[model samples]
Target chain A: MKEIYLDNNATTKVDEAVFEEMRPYFCELYGNPSSMHFFGGQVQGKVSEARNRVAALLGASPEEIIFTACGTESDNAAIRSALEVFPERRHVITSRVEHPAVLTQCRNLTQKGYRVTEIGVDGAGRLDMEEYRKAIDDDTAIVSFMWANNETGVIFPVEEAAAIAKTKGALFHSDAVQAIGKIPINMDGSAIDMLSLSGHKLHAPKGIGVLYLRRGTPFRPFLVGGHQERSRRAGTENAAAIIALGKACELAGQHMEAENTIVKAQRDRLQDALMVAIPNARINGGGAERLPNTTSIAFEFVEGEAILLLLSELGICASSGSACTSGSLEPSHVLRAMGVPFTCAHGSIRFSLSRFTTDTEIDTVIREMPAIIARLRQMSPFGREFLKGQA
Target chain B: MWDYTPIVKDHFLNPRNVGDIPDADAVGEVGSLACGDALKLYLKLDDNKDKILDAKFQTFGCASAIASSSALTEMVKGKTMDEALAISNQDIADFLGGLPEEKMHCSVMGQEALEVAIFKYRGMDIPEHDSEHDHGHAYPDHEGTIVCKCFGITDTFLKKVIETNRLTTAEQVTHFTKAGGACGGCIPKIQELIAQVLGDADVQPRTRPEKLSNMKKMQLIQEVLERDVRPLLWADGGDLELIDIDGSRVQVAFRKACAGCASSGNTARMVEVKLRDLVAEDIVVEEVSA
Candidate 1:
C-alpha cells in the first residue's frame, strides 16, 4: 500500500535539504561555540548565520531570538521567566486551548499562588476577546496564547489580544508552533512581546526551538548552567538542530505561499471528499478562520482511536483527539472546554497537511475513506445508537 | 509500531469476511468504535443445524483486535456450535502465537462474540450466566451499583467470579471479572475487597506451575519492561525506572508523564499489580517517593 502521512501537527518529516544543510555541523564543524578557540569561533559564526536566518523567518532581529530544546521548553521558559522577573504581579492570563507545556506550567504556577485566568474560547475555537480584555487587570503579569490551535487549527487574533495586554502593561506571549511556517508573521508588526517556535513543525529536525523575546523584556533563565544563549538558556548548543532549523526556516520562507495555497486546496479537497463519502461527519471548529492546511472532523458515534488504527492499516497516517488519549476514556479537554457534546468529542480526528502533502495522497484517502467509514459504522454499536437517536 | 502476531498481521493485512452476509441465520455484534473496538459477526447454519456453513465479520479496532475478529470467523467457518463455543480465549491467543495480556481482551471479545452468535442462533439472549448451575459464587446479586466500569462487573459479581474460578488473588479474578485491569480505575476498590475476602486466610494454596518462579518472575518483569511497558511509556512521553527489589517489594520510579501525573500513586500500584500478574503473585510493588 502507498503510505499517506497527513498528521503534520504532530510533527513533519525532516526536509532533505534541511537535513543536508545540517550534516556538516555534526562532524566537521563540531565545536563548542562558547569556547574561545578558532575552531569554536568558526562554529559560532555559523550559529550567528543560522540565528539570522531564523530571525529573518520571523521578521525578528537576530539578537532577540533565544534557542531552546523544543517548543515546550520555549513555552515554559517564556511563561515562567515573565512571572519570575516581576514577582509583584501574580496574575497570568492564557487561553484554555494551549498545549500541555503552557497549561501545566500555568497550573503549577496557580498552585504556587499565582492567579491564572484561563479565558474560554467560543465554539469555533475563537477566543472571547471581550472576556480576554476584562481578564487583564493591572496586576496581570503576562498573557500567553497560541497563534493557532494544534487540534482544531483555528487561528487566534494574537495581535488584538496582545493589544489588550499591552494596554494593561502586561507582557504577551504567543506559542506560534503551528503558525510560524504556514502563516506570515512579522514579529516587529505584531504587538506580541514574545513568541515560541519549533523546528519539527516546519520540517526541521526535532529537539530545537526558538523563543523570540522582545528587547528589554524582563526575563529570568530557566536553566542556569552555562553562558550559552547569552546565559538566557544554558546547555551546549544543538548545532545540527540549530543549522537544520535555520535551513528549515529558509525553506519555509521559500515555500510559504505554495504551502498556504496548494496545501490548503488539497486539504479542502480531501475534507470535501470525506464529507461527501462519509455520513454524520462534521468539521470541528468549522466556524472560525483556521489554518488552510488543517481540518478536524468528528465522525459521529465512532471513536477516534479506531479510525486512526484503520487508517494506519491502509498506510494513511492521521491523528485523532480520542486516539491520543486511548487508555483513558477522557475526551480532549480543548474539545470539552468548547462544550462539544460528549457524543462528538470521542470521534474527532485531525488531518493536518504540510507543504509535502501531495494531490495523489489526498486522492488515495478520498478513495479509501468511504469504504473504511462504512465498514466501521457497520460494526459500531454507538453508530447504531446514534442512528436510533436520529430516528 | 503495533507489533501484531503473524496471524493477526495476516488478518489485518488481508481481513477475511469484511462485509455483511445477506439473509444470515443470526447476527451478533460485540463492542463499538466508541469502545475503541467493535465487531459484527454473521453466521449461516449448516443444513443439519449442527455446524456453521459460513461466517463473516466486520471489525473496527487495532491491528490485533481486527485480526482476532477476522481470525475468529475463519476459525468457526465450518465448525459446529459446540466446537466453536468450546474454543477458549487461550485457543485464540495460541492461534495468534499468544497476544499481549493487555490485548487478551481482544481474544475474550472474540470468544464472547462467538458465544453471542451461537446464542442468537439458538434464539436466546447472550446468557446472563456462563453456566446454568451456580458453581461456587459465579452468579451474584445484580442489584448493587456497578463498581468496575471497564468490565461492568459489579461487587457481587466480583465475589462470585473469585470463588467460582478458585481465584485466590486479584490477578486470577481478572480471567472472569476482567475488573481492576483496564485503566486501573477500580483497582483500589477491588484490592480492598480482595483483602477482605482473602484476609491472610492462607487456606492451603494451589500448586503453581514450576515455571512460575523467582527466576521466571525476573525474566517476565524484564521482558514486560523491555517490551510492552517501555514503549507504552515512551508513547506517553514518559519512562519507568526500576528503583529496588527487596523480597516481594518491588520499587519503581516514573521518569516522565508517569512521574508528573497527579495519579502517580495509582500508576505505581498498577505497575506493581501488572508486574506481579506477569511474574509471580507474592510480589508487592510500590513507588519510591523521593
Candidate 2:
C-alpha cells in the first residue's frame, strides 16, 4: 500500500534542503558561539546569518529575532517575561482556545496569585474580540493571543486584538507557531509586541524556535544562566536545528503562495468528497477563516482511536481529537470551546495537508473513507441507528 | 507504540468475526457512552442446543476493547454452549496475550457480555450488579481504602484467603483473592495483609526450601485447587478429578454433575474455567464423557 500522510498539522516531514543546510553545523562547525576564540567566532558568524534569515522571513530586524528551544518555550518565555516586566500589574488576558503552552502558563501564573481572564471563543473557534477588549485593562500586564489555533486551524484576528492591548498599555504576545510558514507574517507592521514560531511545524527539525521581540519592548529574561540569546533565553543553542529552521524559512518564502493555492484546493476537494460519502459529518471550525491546509471533521458514533488505527492499517496517516486525549476522555479543548457536540467529539479526525500533499493522495483518502466509516458503523449501535435514520 | 503482546496485536490488527449476524439466537450488550466503550455480541446457536454455531460482534471502544471482543468470539465459536459460558474474561485476555492495566476493563466487558448472552438464552435473569451499591461485607480489622472494585477483593479478603489456606505469604493469597493483579493499586494492601497473616501463624521455625520451577504458574494453580476447591467438593459429597491439559484448558471429571441435575449444564459450564485454572496445566480436567 502507498503510504499517504495527511497529519501535517501535528508535524511535517523535514525538508531535504533544510537538512542539507544543517549537516555541516552538526559536526564540522560545532563550537560554542559564546567563546572569544576564532573557531567560536566562526560559529557566532553562522548563528548571526541564521538569525538574519529568520528575521527576514518575519520582516523584522536581525536583533529583534531571538532563538529559543521551541514554540512552547518561546510562548512560556513571552508570557512569563511579560508578567515579570510589570510585577504590580496582576492581570493577563488570553483566549480559551489558545494552545496549552499558553493556556497552561497563564494557569500557572493564576495559581501564583495573578488574575487571568480566559476570554471565550465563538462557536467557530474564533476569539470574541469584544470580550478580549473588555478583558484587557490598565492592570492587565499582557494579552497573549494565538495567531492560529493548532487543533481547529481557526485564524484569530491578532492584529486588531494587539491594537486593543496596545491602547490599554499592555504588551501583546501572539503564538504564531501555526501561522509563521503557512501564512505571511510581518512583525514590523503588526502591533504584536512578541511572537513565537516553531521549526518542526514548518518542515524544519524540532527543538528550535524563533521569538520575534519587537524593538524597544520592555522584557525580562525567563532563563537567566548563560548570556546566549542576548540573555533573553539562557541555554546552549541548537545550532544545527537553528540553521535548518533558517533554511526552512527561506523555503517557506518561496512556497507559501503555492501551498496556499494548491494545498487549499486539495483540502477543499477532500472535504467535499467526505461530506458526500459520510452522513452527519461536518467540518470543525468551518464558520471561521482557517488555515488553507487543515480540516477537522467529526465522524458520528465511531471514536477517533478506531478511526486512526484503521487508517494506519491502510497506510493513510491522520490524527484524531479523541486519541490525543485518550486516557483523559476529554475532547479537544479547542473543539469543546467551539461547542462541538459530544456525539461527534469522540470521533473527530484532523486531516492536514502540506505543500508536499498531492491530489491523488487526497482522492485515495476520499475513496477509502466512506467504506471505512461504513464498516465501523455496521458494528456500532450508534452508527447503525445513524445509517438507518439516513435511509 | 506500546509493546503489545502478540495476541493483542493479532486481535487488534485482524479482529475475528466482526460485523452483525443476520440472525442470532441471543444478543448481549453492555458499556455506556460516558465510559467511552461499548460492545454488542451476537450468537447463533445449533438446533441441537449443544454448541454455538457462530458468533460475531460489534465493539465501539479502544484497541483493547475491540481486541477483547474479537478474542472472545474466537474462543467461543463452534464450542458447546456449556463450554462457551465457562470461558473466563482472564482467558479472553490471556488468549489476546495480555492487556494493559486500564484496558483490563475491556476484557471484563467481554466476559460480562458472554455471561449476559448465556443468561439471555437460558431465560435466567441477568444479575445487574451495581458497582456503586456497597455490599455489607465489613472490614473486620483493615483500615486502608478498598481497591480492585471488580471482585471486591479487599485487604480483608486477602487476610482470610491467607489464614484459611495455610498461605505463608502474599503471593499465594493473590492467586485466590485476585488482589494486586488487576490494576495493582491494591498491592500495598496485599503486602500489609500478608504481614498480618504471617505474624499470626503458629508454625515452628523450620526452613522449608521452596520448590522453584520453570512452571511456577502450573504449581500455583495446583495449590489453589488442593487447598480451596477440594474441600468444598468433599463437603457436597461430590468430587473433581483432573483428566488432561493441552495448554491453559484442563479436562476435569465431575462425579455428580455428569449424571445428576438437569442444570448440570450450569456446573459443567460455570465451574469449568475455575476448575481448569485451579488444576495443573498438563492436567486437563473434564467431567467423564457420558
Candidate 3:
C-alpha cells in the first residue's frame, strides 16, 4: 500500500538531499569541531558554513544563530535565559495555544514565583491583540508565542506582538518551529528578540534546531558547559544534524515558493473536496490567516480517532486534536482555548502538507476520507443524534 | 500509542454489534461526552426475557473504549441476565487480551452498561456503581466521598478496588482504579487509604482542618498574598489579588502585567503551595479571569 503522508506538522520525511549532505559527517568527517587537530579544523569550518546557510534562510546574521537539540531546547533556552538575565522581572507572557514547550515552560515559571499571563485567542484561533497588549508590562521578563499553531496552522502576527513586547521592555520569543521553512521570515529589522526553529519540521533529521537570538540581547545560558555556541548554548555540536539542517534550510529556501503554491494547492484541494463530500464538516481556524500547507477539518459527530484509524487502514497518515487521541481527558488545548464546540472539537483532524505531498496523494485522501467519516458517523451515538435532529 | 493488544486492535477496527437494537428489551448508557468516553448498550432478549439474544453497543470514545464495548457484546451474547450482570470489567479486558491501565475506565464503562441493561430489562432501579469495584456498599443513595477529583473516583470505590485487587502500592491502585493517574493530588489520599486497608491500626484518620468563615479565609489569603507573594510579583511588574474564597479553593486574579501571563497556572500553584505552608495545608489556589 502506498502511504499518503500528510502529518507534516507532527514531523516530516527527511529530505534526500539533506540526508546525502549529512552522510559524510557521520563517519568520514567525524572529527569533533571542538578539537584542535587539522581534521577537526576542517569539520569546524563546515559547521560554521552550515550556520551561515541557516542564518541566510532566516535573513539573520550568522552570529545570531545558536544550534540546539531541537525546538523545545531552543524555546527553553530563550525563555530561561530571559528570566535569568532579568531576575527582577517576574512576569512572563505567552498565548494560550502555544506548543507545550512554551506553554509548559511558562506554566513552570509561575511555580518559581513568576507571574504568567496567557493571552486568549479568538474563536478562529487568532490572538486578541488587546489582551496581549494589556498582558505585557515592564515586569514581564519575556513574551513567548508561536509563529504558527501546530494544530490549526493559524499564523500569528508575531512581528506585531514582538514589537508590542519590546515596547514594554520584555524580551520577545517566537517558537517558529512550524512556520520557519514554510514561510518567509526577515529578521534584519524585526523586533523579535529570540526565534526557535526545528530541523525535523522542515525535512531535516530530528535532534537539530536553531535559536535565533538578536545580537546584543541580554543573555544567560540555559546549558553552561564547555564553550560552544559562543557559550549561549553549550555542548559538542551535533555535527551531522547541524550539517543536515543547514542543507535542509538551503533546500527550504529554494522550495519556499513551491510550498506556498503547489503544496498549498494540494492541501486546499483535499480540504475543499472533503468539505464538499462530507456534510456538516467545517475547518478549524479557517477564518484566520493560516499557513499555506495546512488545514484542520472537524467532521462533526464522528470522532477523530475513528477517522484516523480507518484512514490508517488505507495507509493515509494524518493527525487529530481530539481528546481520545491524546491520553488526556481534554481535547487539544488549542481547540479548547478557541472555544471550539465540544461536538466538533472531538472530531478535529489536522492535515499538514509538505513539498513532498503529491497531487495523487491528495486525491487518494479526498477520495477515501468521506467514506471513512461516513462509516464512523454510522457507528457514533452523536452521529445518530445528528441524524435524529435532521429527521 | 497505547500498545493495545492485537485482539484490541482487531476489535476496535471491526467492532462487533456496532449499532443499536431497535425495539430492544432494555437499554443502558454510561459515561458522558464531557468524560471523553460514553457507551450505550442495547440488549434484545429472548421470549423468556432472561437470555440476551442480541447485544449491540454505540460508543463515543478511543480505540480501547470501542474495543471494550465490542468485547462486552461478544462476552454477553446468549448469557442469562444474571450471568451478564456478573461479568466484571476485567472480563471484558481479558476478552480483549488486556487494556492499558489508564484506559481501565473504558472496560468499567462496559460492565456498568451491562448491569444497567440488566436492571432495565427487569424494570428495576439501576444500582449506583460509581467505582469500578463494588464491594457490597450498594447504598440506595450512593455518594461516597470523592477522593480523586481528577477522575471523580470516591473513597469507598478506592477502598473497594484496593482490597479486592490486594493492591500493595499506590501505583497498582492507579493501574486498576485510575484514582491517582491524573493530577496526582489524590495519590497521598490513595496511600492513606491503602495503609488503612492493610490493617495499620496506628494509621490515624486525617483530621479536617477547622472551617473558617468565608470572610476570614479571604482576609487571611489576602494578607499572605500581599506580604509574601505581592512583593515578588511587584518587582517584575506583576501582582495578584484574591478573587474569591470558596471552601478550600482560593480563587486569585493576576493584576498589573501578570494578568495575561502564560505561566499563571504555575504561579497559582506557587500561591497554593505557599499558602498551604504558611496558612493552611488544604488550601488550593486557582487563577481566575479578571
Candidate 4:
C-alpha cells in the first residue's frame, strides 16, 4: 500500500537536503563546538553560520537567536526567563487555546502563586482582543500566545497582541511552532519580544528549536550551565540537528511561496471534497484566518478515532483533536475554548499538508474518506438517527 | 497510540452486530455525548421472553469502547436474562483480551448497558448499585457525597470498587476506577477509602458535617485563618488577611512577598480546602484585590 502522510502539523518527514547537510556533522565533523582545538573551532564556525541562516529566515539577527532542544523548551525558556527578570510581577496573560507547553505551564504557574488570566476565543477560534487587552495590567510579566493553533490552524493576531502587551510594559512571546514554514513572518518590524519555532514542524529532524529573543530585552537564562548559545541557553549544542535545522530553515524560506500556493490548493481540494462528500461535516476554524496547509474538519455524529483507524487501514495518516486520540477524557482544549459543540468536537480530524504532500495523496484521501465515514455512521446510533432524519 | 490487543482491534474494525433491533424486547442506553462515549444495546428475546435470541449494539466511542460494546453483544447472545445480567465488566474485558486501564470505563459502560437492558426487560427500575458486582450487596445510594468530582464517582461507588478489587493503594484505585484521574481534588478521599477498605483500624469513618449559616461559616473561616494559616504565612514573611466571606467563597489578601509569589494560587487553594475540611467541605478561597 502506498502511504499518504498528511499529519505534518504533528511532525514532518526530514527533507533529504537537511539530512544530507547533517551527515558530515555526525561522522567527519564530530567535534564539540565548545572545544578550543582546531577541529572543534572549525565546527563552531559552522554552528554560527547555521544560527545566521535560522536568524535570516525569521528576519532576526544571529545574536538574537538562541537554539534550544525543541519548541516546548523555547516556550518555557521565554516565559520562565521573563518571570525571572521581573520577580515583582505577579500575573501572566495567555490564551485559553495554547498548546500544552504554554497552557499547562501557565496553569502550573497558578499553583505556584502567580495570577494567570486566560483570554477566551470566539466561536471561530479567534482571540477576544478586548478581553486580552484588559487581562494585561501592570502586574503581568509576560503575555504568551501562539502564532497559529496546532489543532485548528487558526492564525492569531500576534503582532497586534504584542503591541498591546508593550503598552502594559509586559514581555510578549508567540509560539510560532506551526506557523514558521506555512506563512511569512518578519520579526524586524514586529513588536513580539520572543518567538518560538521547532525544527521538526518544518522539514528538519526533531530535537532542534530556535527562540528568537529581541536584542537588549531583559535577560534571564532558563538553563544556567555551559557557555553555549552566547550563555543565553546552556548546554553542549546539538551540532548535527542544529546544522540540519539551518538547512531546513533555508528550505522553508525557499518553499514558503509553494506552501501558500500549491500545498494550500491541495489542502483546499481535499477540504472541499470531504465537505461535499460527507454530511454534516464542517471546518472547525473556517471562519477565521488559518494556515494555508491545514484544515480541521469535524464530521458530526461519527467518532474521530474510528474514522482515523479506518483511514490508517487504507495507508492514510492524519490526526484528530478527539479525546480518544489524545488519550484524554475530554476533546481538544482549543475546540472546547472555541465552544465547538460536543457533537462535532468529538469527531474533529486535522489533516495538515506539507511540501511533500502530493495531489494523488489528496485524491486518494478524498476518494476513500466518504466511504469510511458512511460505514462508521451506519454503525453509529446517533448517525443512524441523522441518516433517518435525512431520509 | 494505545497497545490495543489484536482481538480488540479486530472487534472494533468489524463489530459483530452493528444495528438497532427493530421491535426489540428491551433497549438500554448508557453514557452521553458530553462523556465522549455512549452505547445503546438492543435485545431480541425468544417466545419465552427470558432467553436472548439475538443482541445488537450501536456505539459512539473510541476503538476500545466500540470493541467492548461489540464483544458485549456477542457475549450476551443466546444467554438467559439472568446469565446476561451476571456477566461482569471483567468478562467483557477478558473477551477482548483486556482493555487499557484508563479505558476500563468503556467496559464498565457495557456492563451498565447490560444491567439496564435486563431492568428494561423485566420492567423494573435500574438499581443504583455500584455497577461493579462482587459483594452481591446493593449498598444504599448516596449521590450527594461525590468523592471524585471529575468522574462523578460517589463515596459509595469508591468503597465498592475498593472492596471488589481489593485495591490497597490510591494509584490502583485510580487505575481500576478513574476516580482521581482528573483535577485530583478527591485523591485524599480516595486514599481514605483505600485505608478504610484495607482494614486500617486507626482510620475513622468520615462523618458529614451539618450545613452552617453564612455568618457562622465566615466566623469559622476567619478563626481558622488567624489560628492555622496566618502563622504559616507569617513564618514565610507573608500574611493572609481575610477580607470577606460570601457563603463558601472566602476572599483573602496576601501581604508582603507572598502576593507576588508564583505559588500563591496553590497557597490560596490550600487555605480554601483546609477551611473547607475544617468548616463545611465546600469553602472556596479566592485572592481578593487589596
The top-ranked prediction according to DockQ is 4
Provide the lDDT at A289 for model 2. Answer: 96
- Cα lDDT for residue A338, candidate 3: 96
Best-to-worst ranking by lDDT = 4, 3, 1, 2
Tens digits of per-residue lDDT for model 3, B150-208:
55667876776665445568886776655676468889989999988877533653332
Interface RMSD of each: 5.8, 5.7, 4.3, 4.6
TM-score of 1: 0.74
Ranking by TM-score: 4, 3, 2, 1
Candidate 2's C-alpha runs over 4 A off are A324-326, B21-25, B45-53, B78-88, B119-290
- The DockQ value obtained for model 3 is 0.20
> For model 1, which pairs clash?
B137-B160
* Model 4: fnat (fraction of native contacts): 0.63
TM-score of each: 0.74, 0.75, 0.81, 0.83
Answer with 3 or 4, whichever has the higher lDDT: 4
Question: Which runs in model 3 stand beyond 4 Å of their true positions?
Answer: B127-290
